[model samples]
Target: MNRSNASRGGVAVLVLAGGEGRRLGGGKPLRRVGKRTLLDHAIERGQQWSDTVAVAAKSADQVGNCDLPVLIDQPGIGGPLAGLASARLLDCPLVLTIPCDMPFLPDDLMARLTAVLGNEGASLASSGGRIHPVCGLWRRESLMQLPAYFATGRRSIMGFAEVIGYATVGWDDHWFVNVNTPIDLAQAERRID
Candidate 1:
């Protein structure tokens, strides 16, 4: 939703568009499925549920037509953790971290994510026995523990999740499919279209 018309509970939207996508020949964020680029799809999806939505891009040019703030990954591509660290600096309490590649994320994703936030920190969406770490909702306060986790050279998102604790919310697995390669994009396009 538009931030101007959004309700209470300030939620920040962080779209992970900084990956090099070595498997997809780089600049995957700009790759098109039909009419819109993958990054555009993600920004639109993110904007639907939050007042503020920003793209985490390696370079300003990569995000192209997106009007939202484009945040560069700190240390320049240390992975999703770096993206989360950058996202935490935003002026909102809750942050919705989504990947630009996952164009078909459920429309109710933000609602579902925020609905399950508790004393533990945040909630992650799990489907078909796999946890979608990138499709997570976290509190900005929880990010204080991340710098140490990154310093320890612990890169796995799941590993970090275990330390902080999270609740798993299940949904249809197909909805969380992320396009990592050209083949994956083809498959997702067919499914989503």
Candidate 2:
């Protein structure tokens, strides 16, 4: 049986690791933040929300040694949306999406997103008027709406969120800082220390 499909209920965590991370000199998931790689940190956080956590990557080779299932980006689609598209296949009603680089993503992410999920297809995280659509809880049934949305040739994550009528939960901006550069990694290291 597929590891991702082993769980039939409760929220599943999908850690997005498919980005090329060119800005960080590549191999972003393998980059170290203290003792663990960025991907390791991400998986650790995801485990806080669910035992059925998976990583979404550009390829298995990119993900390296992750014990969790790696959902490769959909053939024709790329980026976080592709990961989400693939994650929807997991045997869970709700999927919580997190990024590989954001080590400090709010611990209460699931709590906040679930509070607003209500009747909408999604509940995204926003901070200081900026939306972090990738770090959100998604409805698997609603994710079935992707093929039709992509049919229009529009790939913006926010665009699909809008099409599905999403709700937003606010957080302090510092909680969403992602490691995308050497300096950003240094900052994360400092934050960890």
lDDT of 2 at 82: 85
The list of candidate 1 runs beyond 4 A from truth reads 1-4
After aligning candidate 1 to the native by TM-score, how far in Å is the CA of 53 from where it should be? 0.4
Model 1 worst lDDT window (10 residues): 1-10
| Over 4 Å off, model 2 | 1-9
* Model 1, residue pairs in steric clash: 1-48
Leading candidate by lDDT: 2
131-156 in candidate 2: lDDT tens per residue? 99999899989999999999999888
Best by TM-score: 2
Q: lDDT by residue for model 1 over 22-94, one digit each (tens)? A: 8998888999987889998898898787778888877788778778888887773367777887887788988
